[model samples]
Target chain A: DVKVTQSSRYLVKRTGEKVFLECVQDMDHENMFWYRQDPGLGLRLIYFSYDVKMKEKGDIPEGYSVSREKKERFSLILESASTNQTSMYLCASSFSGANQPQHFGDGTRLSIL
Target chain B: DQQVKQNSPSLSVQEGRISILNCDYTNSMFDYFLWYKKYPAEGPTFLISISSIKDKNEDGRFTVFLNKSAKHLSLHIVPSQPGDSAVYFCAAIRQGAQKLVFGQGTRLTINP
Candidate 1:
């Protein structure tokens, strides 16, 4: 079975605090993605990494950065957490193919105060 | 603009009945469509998918139908059970692309 694990299930941070969300996938997939899900906005991609040390900005990448130092682990970083940055953060991984399905983690619900 | 839309925010169905969830997309270039089911607090799970070449695909009690001319798709779950209750999201991807555009999602409730 393919499993993706996030570092935290729930987080509360103050404004201007630096926050880090970690993700790890056991399937050895080549692609890793970070997304923030809002109530009516669905899932908005923040960043994605196709290979180690390679990253691409997604639709809403303004306040977030990502790190992919290893194949199994991907990290999402918030430079300066703001109240608007609070949302359910999701991490997903998929193999390199046209018809591949992305495997997702449980997600971290982050709240900025 | 939302490339994919699931306008129906929620739906109710009796057990053993067929539940149909609809989705629409504005992007004409999307050739691959996927459906995912998500329970509260958990991530979405891949349900089924269909390619542009095929109008319909079925696996067990779940069937996905695509209407290219209307830019719409639907997922039919036969004999829906209480366990089938979840939020369903429809996503689309263009040919040879890595990113998937998602819908706002529709919550399905199966009553016993």
Candidate 2:
């Protein structure tokens, strides 16, 4: 079984504040991803890391960035939190293969006021 | 442009009945499809998948049927249980592509 752990399950931040969402995987997968799940919009990818120090922007990358200093850890940074940024954030990891399934963490529900 | 689409936003079914969810994709380059189930406050979990070469794949009570000509796919859950109630998402990936395009998702509710 693969274990993907997020630093926080619930978060609250004020407008203009910076936010950090951390994720760690135990399986040492080479691929890590950050996504935001919204109603009627599905899971939109924010950022993804294929290897340590390598990152790529996904569909919705504005106002967000990512860090992959190590193979087991990936972090998402919100430069300036806003009310619209409040949503459920998910972290997933997978092996570097064509059809490999991604394992996900429980997710963090973020609230920006 | 939305590459993948789940037309049905929600579906309700009895515990012992069959529940069928449908998905469609516009991109013909997609060679692999996957289904995921997500519970409230939890991330989406991989349910089942099918390759373009195969039309059907079955696991336990869940089965996925794909129609390459129609560019559509469907998931059927037999003898649906309360535990099957969740948001189901359909995703697609091109051959050798690392990213997956997902549908909006369909919420399934099972009535006891």
Best by DockQ: 2
Cα lDDT tens digits, model 2, A5-76, are 999999999999989999999998999999999999999999999999999999999999999999999999
Model 1 TM-score, all chains together: 0.98
Evaluate residue A7 in candidate 2 and report its C-alpha lDDT on the 0 to 100 scale: 96
CAPRI-style docking class of model 2 based on DockQ: high
Candidate 2 colliding pairs: none
> What is the alpha-carbon lDDT of model 1 when measured against the actual structure?
0.95
| List of chain A TM-scores, every candidate | 0.99, 0.99
Candidate 1 chain A least-lDDT 10 residues: A35-44
A15 Cα displacement, candidate 1 (Å)? 0.7
* Range of the 10 consecutive residues with the lowest summed lDDT in candidate 1 chain B: B96-105
Q: Write the per-residue lDDT of candidate 2 for residues B63-112, one digit (tens) a residue.
A: 99999999999999998999999999999999988898899999999999
Score every model by TM-score: 0.98, 0.99
